[model samples]
Target chain A: MAEKSSELKLLSAWFSPMALRAKIALNIKGLEYENVEEDFNSKSHLLLRSNPVHKKVPVLIHGEKSICESSIIVQYIDEVWSNNNAPSILPQHAYDSAIARFWVSYIDEKLFVCAKNIQDAGKSDEEKKPHSEQLEEEMLVRLEEAFNKCSDKKPFFGGNNIGLIDIALGSFLPVLGLIEEINGRMVLVEDKFPGLINWAVNFAANPAVAGTFPEIDKLILFGKTLLKKMGYCL
Target chain B: MAEKSSELKLLSAWFSPMALRAKIALNIKGLEYENVEEDFNSKSHLLLRSNPVHKKVPVLIHGEKSICESSIIVQYIDEVWSNNNAPSILPQHAYDSAIARFWVSYIDEKLFVCAKNIQDAGKSDEEKKPHSEQLEEEMLVRLEEAFNKCSDKKPFFGGNNIGLIDIALGSFLPVLGLIEEINGRMVLVEDKFPGLINWAVNFAANPAVAGTFPEIDKLILFGKTLLKKMGYCL
Candidate 1:
């Protein structure tokens, strides 16, 4: 992917999965951007001005324009930077693109919500595990089926290379790891999700995704602090 | 939009806003399709098989393929049948498309959710209305702003044609009307949302969107039955 002339800036928080999706897509596209970090307690004026609706981070300022919402941002990246040399994040075919969009949405509305609920469960770990496990069983099993259906024996969700689904789910790895660490139980089990376990390994090792995840130890520490603030007795 | 060869079938509930979005897009595209009504009390096997992920209606079965989720289904219809003659629902430019998608998302998550909370609030009208009004002040006001920005002085959110945002927000008109009728209050106020008021009138009168809305009396009856089931007093 060749860089374009427009000055790209990402308003991001270091630990935010939403922001991470933007970062990974930018990296994959070979697009150079300024990372303008936001402090949540007091968000930056630019962020407030740029995203008046949600007033949230992961707002991508592309020259004069700003795009918000993580998945939409990723799609914008794929669309704008699509060139013959650049890898397509979304599939080129319309049906395939629809399927990819569906899964990406599932990641946003389902998988990520489950992970957040586990993180903020506030109950004793013993009291929380069953509910979390049930959520996982209902959600992740479908995801595994999605992987098989979408990947079509290829290595990545984008088939052969990283695509939209990869960026969507892969961004949550560090956070998922933190949840597992805190709960002292595996959220992504080897026995239950062998395909996903294998996919996760492949995803982390990919060059484009390698540095996109936050450092696990730091993430866990941050996670515990946030959980404590939310009334969890971690 | 010219008719395509693939046989299109829609599994739908009569009053679902989600199903209505798909129907509007299909109408705008001038694509003819079979409408299979579902008794949600016992959803059909085809629906169960077609959309195992959400297992909800508004699944578009094209020839041998089935696409679920209304927004995605709309997007798919736009992409697959995109011709020089067909009006593009999503904007052509990447930035414009992103902006459209963002507002469509707001319509789904914010506007529709607020409307639902107002409908499903089991408390007395006085008890429920203040909270609902506050939600409206926060949400519909932004939607009014969105209509102004996205529509850009045009008659519809799609600008010169009924685009994705128009379809997204327009689908809820009949349901919003139902809410207004049942509560004996105006959810979409003329003074507050003058632009949207005019836009809704334009949208309803458009030949493509005309007759797409379920009959108001039928919708009101169905809505009351649903609200009673949800423990709301008419």
Candidate 2:
């Protein structure tokens, strides 16, 4: 077994779901790491050097090597730690693993697009309202379809255990909630998607996720202020 | 070692790079399989039943189990046949494996977007000329950057050997070349991106890719007629 590293370091920013996913994955795996927060406005040279291609946060630096992309980082963590002591983030069975990965890919392709639109809506001028709303509606519909496909028996995506799907979806929940609160619109209404709502509740309740989630109030206030400045406020 | 099946089945379409990746992977691995051509317009019940969610192709139905998603299916092939007399597609080193996976993800996200735009342009009407041209330009720029990033290396994305990155990118070359030829545009010019051009040429020279690649002349003619009907062609 490769000796567990005590010198794992994370380059991250507060309120970034991508970074939060990496943090949560590390915590779940019982890996100890120093968290280095990077300013989005004035990104650190380390972050830039670590991920020159994307220069995005949620870069996991282990000793000498750095891994970028949230999902990629999560997979790296799972592969490095071997997922023995920690909960298995990937499905045990190969087929189930494929399914989990499929959903994760779907989340990246579909759900994230909607989330980006909503974020952009709050960041764009009044003229972008039509485009933003169109994107939001499209995303919500897709989310509804995705939620419908889930069986209530599985609290998490992989039947009773939080796996890759949960992490993928959970990472976006904080931002979704913040966006809704700022916009005064409930995108993921509990009444509309009870199962998804319950899933979110249970996911957020997980110690690994709940412990490190960003401050919701801070995110909401920041989002609202940004929206107002962009002339897209309620 | 698991016995290799006498007859393998590939569920795929003509224009899908996702399907093409699987085809190339199987060929590189030197596995002989029965090709099951699928019509995208009216998908066969088998394709739908096998992959209900996406209902898309490149679904490799080995003996009993079915695998969907080009990247996942490729990994599945590499894993199941690890001990067999197949060419090793993935890198042995974990970091290299991660890098290979990263490029695969990049192809799916960035390269696929460009391919989609080019396809959409060829399928649109005359009024959509501006949209098509803009998409073409965007794809060219993105492809240029992608080529530049990989140009420092050898003919392939993984240095000398044709690895997963080559498989991923090669699958799209036929379609990209077809689009460029039909549109009378030089999206992937030799002088502009010689490395990428060389990579594509080497990929096409591969018996696996070259053998299974769709005929560009036929595809170009088909695209022209389709675009003309859609009012896109002059």
Candidate 3:
């Protein structure tokens, strides 16, 4: 076993989905590391130095090297640990792996767009209603199409277990749920996307997810504050 | 040896960097394939059906499965042909692989932003001149910072080999170079970034790149026609 030292630390923010991905991956792999939470309002010099371009979290500092980008960090963890016993997150078959990666990339691109829309809506006033609704519909339509094409019999993305796809999608559920809660609108309605809703539930129920997820109340409170600061909340 | 007859087939567009990635990977690995060029303006039904969401080009159909997304396809190719004697594009060391992936991801995100700016500039009038210069400078600054920090001292992104980083960056060089050629300005001048310039030259000189690249003059003509159609050219 690799030496479990204080050297492996994760620099992250409390309510970041990207940060959660690294946390979940580490927990799933049974790796222990120190968590150094950053203040997003005023980032630290370490964070700036570690990831100068996109000085965002979560930044995984293993030994002296820093690994930014959540999805890439997860893949790195999988490679380093070789956790074959811990529910193979990535598919062994190359084609299946590609498929998993495609969905992950899609989530990175599409889901983030959706999240951005929700954030925009929260920050916008009455004049932006139509645009916000259109954005919401566009995001849902894409998700629905993806869900329809996804294998029907599979409990997870790849049929049997929670893999890379689950991790990618699962990371967003908290943010999605929080957005809906704060807005008092259901973007991912149960009837509209049963597969996605069920998947979300299953994902949330996972031990790793259940363990590391940010407290819902805390995030909701944070969202409310953010919206007010942005002059969205009345 | 793997069954040469059962090798994968790739569907690509003539002027697509994504397609070039798959093509280069195939050449690097010495894999035999049937290349069917798709018209981007009028995409084939097979391509559309294969990738409903994006409906984009550079779709690799390997036997029964279809893989879209250039980076994903390259990784898939690497995974499937793991036994091949070609140097593994992915670094063996975990930290090194992470670093390589970071650059790949950065290229996918930041470099594409610059490319989009250049493309948009080509489609704009004199009013957009400042925007184009600003975008060019932003791209150059980021590239310089990235290249400065790169671990490898070799001409390639990865040291002493053409790896994932090379493939990712190589795909974009044609478009970057063409943008400069069309604008009558050189963004990536040799004096400013000699390492990156050498890197581009080394990449262009690779047999895989030389064989598969589209004609520059033809591309410049096409780009001019495109700008004319978009009302940027008289």
Instruction: Please name the candidate that would achieve the greatest DockQ relative to the true structure.
Output: 1
Per-residue accuracy of model 2 over B8-97 as CA lDDT, tens digit each: 789987756678889888877778787899975578998998887678788988877778899988877777676677667777666667
Candidate DockQ values, in order, are 0.89, 0.43, 0.81
Best by the TM-score measure: 1
What stretches of model 3 exceed 4 Å from their correct place?
A1-5, A121-154, A158-160, A227-234, B1-7, B121-138, B148-151, B227-234
Model 1 chain A is weakest, by summed lDDT over 10 consecutive residues, at A225-234
TM-score per candidate, chains pooled = 0.94, 0.81, 0.89
Residue-by-residue lDDT tens digits, candidate 3, A1-234 = 433758689998777888888988887786789899987668899999999878888899988789999988898888877754665667778887888888888888876765665566444656445545654676556655665566455666745666787787777877877777856787777777777777777778877778677788888887668755754321
lDDT tens readout by residue for model 1, B1-234: 455535899999887889989988888788988899988678799999999888888999998989999999999999998984768999999998999999888887777776766677465777667657765687778878889988889999889999998998898788678777867878788889998998999999998888888899987887778756845322
- Model 1 residue B1 CA deviation (Å) reads 6.8
List where candidate 1 sits over 4 angstroms from the true fold. Answer: A1-6, A124-127, A230-234, B1-6, B121-127, B230-234
lDDT string, candidate 2, A80-101, tens digits: 7874577777766666667677
- Single out the weakest 10-residue window by summed lDDT for candidate 1 chain B: B225-234
Write out the backbone clash pairs for model 2: B125-B231, B125-B232, B126-B231
Which consecutive 10 residues in model 3 chain B have the weakest lDDT in total? B225-234
Model 3 chain A is weakest, by summed lDDT over 10 consecutive residues, at A225-234
- Deviation in Å, model 3, residue A62 alpha carbon: 0.8
Worst 10 residues of 2 chain A by lDDT: A225-234
